[model samples]
Target chain A: MVLPSFSNPGAGPADAVVAASPTAPLDAFLDNQPQTFYESIYRSEAACLCILRLLPPVCRQIVLHVLWSHQTLKSADLKAFCGMDERLAPDAAEEVIRPARDRHIFLSLNHKGNKFQWPLSDTFKRGLRNALTGLGTSNSFGAPYARGPRDEVPTAEALTDYGEDTWESILKYMVSSGLTNGYRGGRPRNSVLLLLYQSGLMADPYDRSGHNPKLEALTITSKGFQFLLEDRQTQLWQILMYYLAGKQARGENAADILSLFFSLGCMQLGQDYSASESFPHMENVLDDLEQYGFVYRTEMGRERGQFFPTHLSTTLCSGESGASRSQSADDKRFLILETNYKIYAYTSNDLEIAILNLFVNIRIRYPNLVVGRLDRRHVKAAMDKGIAAGQIISYLNSHAHPQMYNHPPPILHPSVTDQLHLWDKERNRLGAQESVMFEFFSRELFDETRDEAERNAGLHLALPAKKLLFVDPNVREAIKDFIKDKQVQLRGGI
Target chain B: MSYHDPYQVKASNGTLITCDSAAKQILIHLDAQRDGPQKFIIRDVDDTHVLIKSIYVDMVRTSLQEELEKNTYDQDPAL
Candidate 1:
């Protein structure tokens, strides 16, 4: 299940073709896994999404720094990589690496003495490299448009709007199906439906709710819950990757498709890429991709032919961090909430309003911006929808008003942040939960075992579990200890 | 975005393979097609060092050209 970056099997530039060695099989690692009593908490989708959203750059930074590096890095060396302090170094690496590890994105190496040697998982590193730098012919980037077609090149704005509209339509479709009180109708393509189905997002679409009856009218499953929590950027990549992986699964020649997709990212926005150059089957794939706002093609005056990648397509090569490059892009901004709780957003775009409408109540709409306030009712309303305080704060921080950019701290008002969290506390409260291990035969064994568990899980004692000789309660801690002990014993350890 | 046909431009010696205009920043391509280890030099507009691996020149050029074309066309409405 190591996703090879090649997109296609056995194809691409000579240097780009990395043969899989199949040296260490995964089953060997999983063979002696412990029961659910000691599973990693971050192993769940919800946790992965929250962590990714909270710290995106950290994820990218960690993965990129270690792509071709060591199996485990010294705690000090890890700190150096991110320029963080000793305290944050170990845990940050754990939080980022654990998710990647769970997703098979990397393999963790055991610590030696005071250091850890962290190496990029062979398959994942290769895939990451290929994805970051268009290496092979699978050119998952995108293909150049055909030279002949005159019509079909879509404008950048068109592509952006199209992507937004198509995506929103899907959301609307999901919402309107009486699943969320019959919102309205907006349908995404069958491909998206197939993708969701494949990702376990929409299982057995044939349910009585007619959730996926037309494939377009779908319901937001628990998977959708997980999906919504991910940053907008990740959601796009997730869907795109889902499609790419799905095509490969269905026996289609994924090389051309992938290469074509990558090529789409590298492609110029308004110019026509020669479609004739595409794999014959890709002609159909383009239309579907268009619905997803992946590309936009328009016909010119009937003779000169071709289509161009929209911002979506071009940004692909730019990497999945998606236009975070254009952090300066003016249009990227949205809500502007003040200490007075007055919110002023620059666009009345339904999507922008809808997103803002999540946390603040819109008083009315001005032509350019929507004026609103983060009221108690709205914040409470939002909490019911599962948008947590942390999520709201981060979302606001990422899209902080340009004016707010000049403030002393410059992210958001502390008052608003505290209030939002208060709103969250009002609805849902969190207390750290842990399990206790009782009555270890001896104190030495208890001490050694607890230390071992902490070391393996990359976690520490939250609090000594009550009456427990060895207090190992963190999900990761227990699992890590279980795996490490099992492995050591199997190898005839003293 | 309207892309200029790559065929429209001639590869002049020492010409940076940028878009049609002088203002368009030329992306560097380190051609490995030369004998032994191919050598090349490229400076960013700010004269910052931009590493160009000798092995990936043609790929860099083609991909950059593709990228620039896409961006330019994305900017152009008449495409």
Candidate 2:
């Protein structure tokens, strides 16, 4: 059986880690990483996290089974392991496993018997398993060991806003650091700057003149560019992990940090609890976490009191799928688009506007509203910058105009969406280049094949032009069948 | 068609007048009356064949049928 690595200060060298079970299979597998214990738990928490993050439960279960076994299991084996009563196994293999392998989380191989063998990547497996099972450290999820006053918790709304604010501050901090004197015209705390430097997201550019001591400027790196494009939830996790890695480097107890982060995810959002009481080692990290907006404190009470978690804190370690920070109501969009290319937004948030401005060419901005046109150049530029039309459309779809949601239409502005696609087509131009041609000696054969093609597939056959038959892109496969079937029928009847 | 006697009509001196039996039947069928203002038909049929034939044209068949039924009820108290 696998057991946790224990560190005893007086037993031997302080830096040495001692595993309880040397013979366990996982022992050799555990590398001397900065946060091995946390990584294990994080890996274990992977499936549960994925589940909570709103990934389909089927994928989560499959991931769990795959991550558990060291060997690559076949699709049939997965189906059996997940219990054969389900129908999603085949789809999970195709959609989840294949995509996960592409994402570098799973490794896929084709065996000799025409079967696929799948296994979770080592880091992903260990991290996910450790997280799900809460192995290694006791502090992975949260500690409800200490009691607190029942009435001290904040309301859900308060917690949500608090989370957004804190998370926004971290983002603002990053962006500001790239700007003049960074955002707030003041240097961030040394630890914050160090963490930023360690994450390699931004750099402090030094001047050539030795006399200019305070003339340092910050420049965002390429990684920062990609990092900023990710939604707030992902950015939050990245920053937190970055900070955690920094702490681990400082020889601070890594297990405690892991437990705290995982614990934060499991903590109640509104309730205030003493950090010193529950996690004594976390006292040093509390100020930083507060700056991250995970905790809030009130001084109006009898005790000099502890802070409570925000929704951001609670969701910091949320898994990838369902429990995504994006899925929450607070983060959902309230804008809809029309076919006419007229844009309407229903929010007054400046951050959202700033984000939208990264793509859309705004025509006008008003109080609580902004109107924009999705021009060709704008879309092309966004595409060039690694954003897809589908992502843009999905973003709009997800945050459809509140009024549009109240009075939904079959399609969100067919004209505007079509125009967007038309622009893409105009820029590419290869879409209209292809035409299909077929040769048949007999007119009777031609007519019969055409009828068959029309019946079997709802192909939009263009009116007869030349020797070519133009059909809708989706039903082209029917053409080959039609030709073969007609030849067979003619041969048989003769 | 055996005649009993030659009938003659008198203006000054009194004389017996005779009319055809078919013409008399038609006149009797055409000149009918109702007992009250509330009743509908202005004519009645004396012959059973003529009455049955004219039943389709009777405008007051509903009230007449009610009156007939009331007369039948009067005759039988059990109804």
Candidate 3:
């Protein structure tokens, strides 16, 4: 059986890029679904299009080739098409065919008088063809709402601002929940709060359950710290994955939710989609998604409303890096780090300030700039709260001011980065091991046991002068047997 | 010579501490204090090494940091 290329030793740099890319989690999530789930979801054109977009370029080429051809192609044909010979066939199979097959996009069959031929899954092929040619029922992609003359259509800029504000509020809540008394400002919806706790990103210090969990009682976990360091797209997907997993655990149908996400991914940003006509019975899910900033919905008084897919949903399967999506032009390079461990941020975004405050000691704040210093005490406190030194360093490096980039590579000052790393290393000075300490009465017995432990590669420490030996706990029984054998030898000799 | 049941074996989940001889001496001193019900050092292996209880590793590290901080010089300006 072929394994995913990411897990293989000889996987190329392209595979490594895909593995580190944001789409990797979505790809892995789809690959982990049961065959039956694929059979059902692949029937939708939107799901097929989203999944196709998520595949590696090589896999996409193979799928497109197989989709057009009626004949089953052998591995040799596939390798030749992908510009590889027999020697590289194994790599192609491992990298391309394995993942596609795992997702049920391609099926490897034993054809008559031919070794394993590849064919696209029938349902996936039909759905993808219809999606590309716009031939099938167009309901897979949400129906565009016909706006009335009196309806006020929101501009793209307004929609983007709305989505960002709603999203940033959730992040602010997570950050402030870690503060001493928590922020007294607006909190995200209770469903989001519950999802944060349920996803293990936040915990109640008092472990109280049932009904609304107090915002101050919640504390961000280590995973939450790591999540905060991630790009906005990754952060969004992480929450959605946790939500889907939670739904699955509660015995709810997650396939419907998955399909909805894929349908949203195929949607156009700022285009209004009719809720009643497009999603039918998924109004509650749509409302919940609106709360998470996936979509912006007009108020529904007595009739059905329309929802506009935000940038978050439109780029869900596009695999665009979060850096491009999250960074605004004005604040793209807002941070300036000095050799003396000082940081000057050129924006007034509260979320950025809160994130910087995770590891930096904020000294002063101005209208458009904030000055902070990275010191041992504050950094160590952040580390104590489970923020890694690497995350802090990367955050600084990624946000370095354009002036800093004017110099050569190593954008952040090397001294500052080195000092941060050293501070992190300081916490790992001691190493722990569970072992058995053997105190021998006779020098001969100690020597015998120490040698035995050494042969087994279980010796932790040995003091020949003091007749003491420390061996791994796992090898204690073997050491005892060796001692018994040595005692028998000594008795027989006497 | 009689071996007398060969050897006595004791097992524990321990943290192997390796530091300078002076730091080890400080650790030994700290372990000797009866400030808490539990001591830090499990056994002194050598001049520069000690086996410590894993549970007290953080406490031992903090105390060691505090002891070492007295000799270090700070050059950062007051904020």
The most accurate candidate by lDDT is 3
Q: Count the backbone clashes (under 3 Å) in each candidate.
A: 64, 43, 0
lDDT of 1 by residue, A1-59 (tens): 11113233123321121121111121222223332311331222222222223334666
Best by DockQ: 3
Fnat, 2 decimals, each candidate: 0.00, 0.00, 0.39
- The residue ranges of model 2 lying beyond 4 angstroms of the native Cα positions read A1-56, A59-153, A172-190, A204-216, A219-222, A249-255, A299-305, A317-331, A338-341, A375-397, A402-494, B1-79
Please say which candidate is ahead in TM-score: 2 or 3. 3
Q: Report the poorest 10 consecutive residues by lDDT, candidate 3 chain B.
A: B1-10
What TM-score does candidate 1 get on C-alpha atoms? 0.49
At residue A475, candidate 2 shows an lDDT of 50
Candidate 2's clash total is 43
The candidates, ranked best first by lDDT, are: 3, 2, 1
- The DockQ of each candidate is 0.01, 0.00, 0.37
lDDT: the better of candidates 1 and 3 = 3
TM-score to true structure, per model: 0.49, 0.47, 0.84
